[model samples]
Target: MDFRFSPSDDAFRRDARAWLDAHPPAEATPRQWERTLGADGWIGLGWGRTPYGNRTATLTQQVVWAEEYARTPHTPPRLGHIGENLLAPTLLAHGTAAQKDQFLPPIARGEAIWCQGYSEPGAGSDLAAIRTTATRTTATRTTATRTPSARTTSPRTPATYRVTGQKIWTSHAHEADWCFVLARTEAGSHRHHGLSLLLVPMDQPDGSVEVRPIRQLTGTSEFNEVFFDGARAHPDHVVGGEGNGWRVAMDLLAAERGVSTLAQQIGFGEELERVLEEARDTADPLLRDRLVRQWAELRTMRWNALRTLGGGPDPAAPSVAKLLWGGWHQRLGELAMAVRGVAATAGPYDWTESEPYELDAAQRLFLFSRADTIYGGSDEIQRTIIAERVLGLPREARGQ
Candidate 1:
């Protein structure tokens, strides 16, 4: 497959680069920056012309924009990416027309931020094991017994879901205006059955929803633990229908590893460049060889990602991509520490002081990348998927 960008794609790249250059991240706060991008129609480039007011771009053009954005220096990490990249694509694929109409506009406008509510304390990579529950309910109640005196009734109201459960490692949950929760909607359901992907409002007036940040090795708290106590979602907000959330969640995971991977590769390239600079004077031949290998493998990962573009949903594609990037990133992190040697062990603060301290760039990279193979579906789970689903291997035994 040809990976080269066309002349028109080059033109699109120039336009995107020009816009990013003119609007440096220092000029605006992250939220304001998001709004600015949305107003200019830069948020949902991959989605075609819809009433959502998103700028329509071809697949190659989307790649161009992503690469350009990542290549730009000092661009703040996007505050709207969960909405734009993950949820938006999922909605386009499986959401009802009403869902698209209601959700896409705010995402395109960058007015609403979103976080995912997929992981649980016991069900991180094994999403089918999630125990969160969203029970269907109505404002009124009705009960009847054989005895005439036992009959009771009340006025009916629109049905809603009373969500109750906890979600762990919820990225950006504290800042998100909304969350798409994967919860079992049917009573006594197990594994993948009877699940529903719920579009939930985060700002519950009754204090039914809570977010607590989990401090990380990098001294950052982007990952969070979220508790839901009778939080509500409209019955209409159940995406991909009430009992088909497993499929919808799988589709969203596919989107997670799609075009977004290319942009991610660009960021990896920047990190590799930093590592390369740090290793320039290294005397160990083995270390130098490993550095060269990292550069080559990253290039290969990019080409592989480009090759899979526009290929209709192949179950193996996402698993393969995840395996490649996850391990590569973790290795890069390790290499970064190796290059820094003993200096990597210490932070730039007085250890005896009681105040909090920060990890330097290399330390942060090493510590955070340790989770690369764990989060977003662990390496073991990815390989199992390939074996059972793609390679037609016998299923692994599971405990009841």
Candidate 2:
């Protein structure tokens, strides 16, 4: 596919860059920043003209917007990305008209934050092995029925599903207003057969949903453990109908690696530049060679990503992108520490002080990047997908 941008695309890039420059991030919180973007019609660029008043941009323009946003310094990590990037695309593909109408407007307006409820303690990489369940139920109120000469009463109400289970590694669950949950909806069904994607509200008034932040090695708590005990979901909120969550979830995963990845690469490039600046005076040939290799690999990854941007049905594209970036990021972290020498091992803290300490950029990068190969999907799982699906190899044996 041709990678060249049209003049209009260049104009869009300039407009995006100017807007980003004019609106300095300053001290805006993540949610405030999201609204800021939405106010300027910067959010939901990929979505075409909708009744919700979202700006429509071409595919190239979307890429340009992502690149420009990443190039901006001190921009807060987007809290609305899961909703705008992942869930929005999935809804466009597999959600009902009502689902889209209900969810898409809030996302486009940056008024709603969403978390994904997919990974479980036992079903992280093997998503089909999920054990969470959504049992169908109904609420009813008495209605008078005229029979013979007397009035009789009957009860009836709308159908809803009671969700019950735990989801670990749920990113931003504590801050989310909603969660798209994958749970078993069929009785006695195994593996992928019985799953349903239910749009559940996170702010349950009855305390059915609970979120516990999981502190990480970097002393941050972006991921959380979410427990749903009898959480309610309306029947109308089911995406792609019931018992079809496996496909919808896969579609969302595919959406995860699109234009946003180019923005991610821009961030990676910035990190690499920081590492290079730290290593500028180093005389060690080995360290210099490693930095050059990293630079080269990042370029290659960008090209590979661009090559796959046409949205062809390449089964291995998403897995390939994941493996490339995951390992590359981990290595960059190691190199960051290497450039920092022994000083990277320590932080600014007083053990006697009641307050907690903070981690510098290098230390935090080194520590957090350790999970790069593990989260999202592990290296082992990615390789298995490429082997069995892309190369037509025999499937790995599993215990029944």
Write one digit per residue (lDDT tens) for candidate 1, span 144-190. Answer: 44655665555557688999999999987998999999999999998
lDDT of 2 by residue, 1-400 (tens): 6778899999998999889889998878888888888887778888788777678998788989999989888888899999999998888888888888889988988889999999999999988889999999866776898988899877677778999999999998999999999999998898879899999999989999999999999888989999999999999988898989899989899889889999999999999999999999999999999999999999999888888986677999999999999999999999999988998887788989987778888888889999999999999999999999899999998754
The lDDT of each candidate is 0.91, 0.91
Clashes of each: 0, 0
Candidate 2 segments exceeding 4 Å error: 139-157, 351-357
Q: What is the total number of backbone clashes in candidate 2?
A: 0
